[model samples]
Target: MKWTHSRLFLAIVALIGIVTFANLLQSFYRPYLPTITSLSTTNRSDVHENISHEDSASRISSGQGVKNKNLDICENPYLQPGYVWYSNTTEETNTTWVPFYPSLLDESYSSTTLETTGEPVDPYTSDGDPYFPTEQPPQELLDVSPHPWMQDIVRHYKLYNSSLALKQGGSSSRSREVLEREELENRLHWLRNRRILIVSDSVDRYQSEYICNRLGLELINSNKGRQTASWCHIPMWNLTLMNWHIASVSPTKPAWWWIQSMQIVNVEERWTEYYLPTLNDTIGMNGKSPDLILFHTGLWDHTYFIRAPEAIGGKASWARSLNWRELRFYMQRVRMVITMLREQFGDDVPIMCRSVTLKKSLPSNVSILNLDRAARFVCNELDIEIMEFGEIIRGYFEFYKDMVHIDRGPLSVLWANMVFWYLFRTQGGVEVRGDLIEMPSNGTEIVNVAKEWNTCHGDFMNAKRY
Candidate 1:
């Protein structure tokens, strides 16, 4: 109460020092301050209460709400360290588990949904797409033999079963049959109630035949009659593979014209009576449309009209090369087939167009163009997937005989196994395995003799995988 000059001077000096310290503190924290205009002190409490309520409601809706008095709400966001508000965000218990992808929620990012169909995303699923020859192979002497995996497969079954048969007092044929059945069962189980329909020419039929043998189905004799369409069933596997033959989806000329032009005419004449009927009956055999339909045809069309040296089934009979008009019509017919399948299946089935199996075949305009049309019209339009099988097998054309048919012996097994691996990794959602068989040198050309196969069966005992 007693005023003194010295005491007043000291008080004034202390006040000046305190003000300087406050200014220094403010300048140090200025960079971290939020740019928003500061709220009045009267409304700041209400704002904090509102944010706490909003966060509480979000947590409750996300099923993570539990009162935790120790948890502090974001009150002074600007003063707090980075992402402190994110700590306030509660983790939800109800969100369905998804594969941890950093950019999964980004709008510009998209991916195939095959792995997310309530199935675990395994290594093969996350791995890159399957490899195939998409270009004409250079003249490199690649070993055209059974893939190493295929040889291992042959050894595992043939030798092991033969030795087991000797010990059990059973014939080697009995051992072969047992192992064949077991392999079939394994393939069927891997398929997991899926069906495949392969529509192609004689070359692809060889593939079907190989698959049938693996499953122990009897091969139909061709000399008796070339079965335009046939199927074999494995009841335990609940799987059916149907091989349907078609030279071209769209013929260059009228039915009468095709009939008169060449001995091996385009089979468009049989569209209604033969092709469509077989497809209608064969597919949906197991109370469901085929999971996959592989369409392969360009080789037959190219050979039939182009007078290529390796004309399918013999030499080309055509006197002149087919003009663009004919080629366009052929493409139209192929496009029509894709449209027809989409209309029939209603986006439930995945259709793939196999590119022409020929050396330097990437530029085979017919196959590439038709496949593009399919992807656009059927896959994109129908909101489904129409794959290109050629992408996976295009690289192995060297292993193919005549650059058309997959070489029967071990090469055929390789090709078939490639297809199986693709289906298993991409669609089957199961462990990958193959149903392979060692074929005779004649390859898949001739109708396999069942009686002979049941007997010695083409050096099966003498042939070593190594």
Candidate 2:
């Protein structure tokens, strides 16, 4: 009886050992199982599809889960053309130029009236000019020189060490070397001659203005008073001719010219009466006939409450209920504008959209639920290419002064570099660098005095000389 009991106890111990061993193996191999969820899986796909279809407000409120790993939704084999991934890193490294054969070339070259007027008058007239003229000069005629200040600016912005900033004596040779390394001179020269338009809200106006000033292009604001009826003409012997109309305000006429408009609207205002009509008007007129339309409108919409006027009391309520439904309606309006632009401009016109910028801290009555999730849902539904501004600015938060605006120094340099990199990738134009010119960093020292007036205070009485 004692021997039988011992054998049974040994069998029970063996079973326990097997169970322990199995658990250890399971824990060891758990990490080796797929860390990323496959989008092809039935469960994940269904969830994503539902999230994508939800109203922007509902998505904002619910804060749906987004698989960060599967950002490249347009990567499928049957993807449409002109779906660009706009990133400074990717543009600098991964982009390759493909010769774009103009679809209307055969039709355009055959027309005589169009050539003379610099406009498409008739589609059928045959002219002596070759159909689909090429504008880029032969590789030999192209100048591949870098701007003198290109290196200094790049170093100041990119080189993190303050010691380098102070110790590094500004050298023309060093500037030349930097420019040569990045091929900035040639790139700038090409860009100077290309017609490009920048349309943005107040936040991006400084960058856009700086770029225009640096490149010798006119800057026009969308605000009514700032509008100017000026046309920018680029003279190139090869088939390259571009015209620019930079306006902060929506254009009065349909943009029939080869215009590339950058649309950056403030999304924060209430959509019921004031902001919606303005947006609709802008979209109706300027959204069509764009060669490349870059859309960015997410920052202002989140983090703030939009309160309707109370019927009984005059005072604004702190616990004012938000009109999220109205917000989603405007978002859908934006989507419609995108669709119309795609239809009018054709699918090949590159549409680059931007995600909302991140705030350092959350606002009162606002949670993370209202911002990023809404942006992701709208982007998914619209089928637009997203430039992940939040992710890009994560490491470089110091570049920003406040919640939204960036410092002028870093902002200008960053925009210039981005534009340079983008133009390089898009095969738009080479950099144009003329004689080396140096100006004061700040415009404080002006030799000639314009009438000194404090516009904010409306005081022109005091005139002091520096």
TM-scores of all predicted structures? 0.44, 0.38
Q: Give the Å shift of residue 300 in candidate 2.
A: 4.1
Clashes of each: 4, 20
lDDT string, candidate 1, 1-466, tens digits? 4568878988999999999999999989975553322222323234333332233333334432222221122211111111100111121111111112122233322222222233334555644544342321111101111123333334344554556667688445555656664654343344434466777777778776765565446545323134466554544445556666676554444333333423334455544545566564445533445656776666556544444334344454333445556556665676666666656654445555554554445445444444344333433443333233344345655556664566554445544544543343223121101112212222112221222222221222222221
lDDT of 1: 0.43
Tens-place lDDT digits, model 2, residues 1-466: 9999999999999999999999999989974554333333333323334323222233223322221222221111101121112233312221112111112133322332233435343577555433444233222111112222333333333432333453476533444444453543232333332222223333455555554444344544324223221122222201111111222112122232112242322222222222233332222112433223445544433322232233333443433334577456545755654565456456544454544455554442242234445545675665554434333444444556675565545434534444433323222211212112222122112211011101101111111111
TM-score of 1: 0.44
**Per-residue error (Å), model 1, residue 138:** 24
Report RMSD (Å) for each prediction in the order shown.
24.1, 27.1
Model 2 accuracy (lDDT, Cα):
0.35
lDDT for residue 99 in candidate 2, whole number 0-100: 17
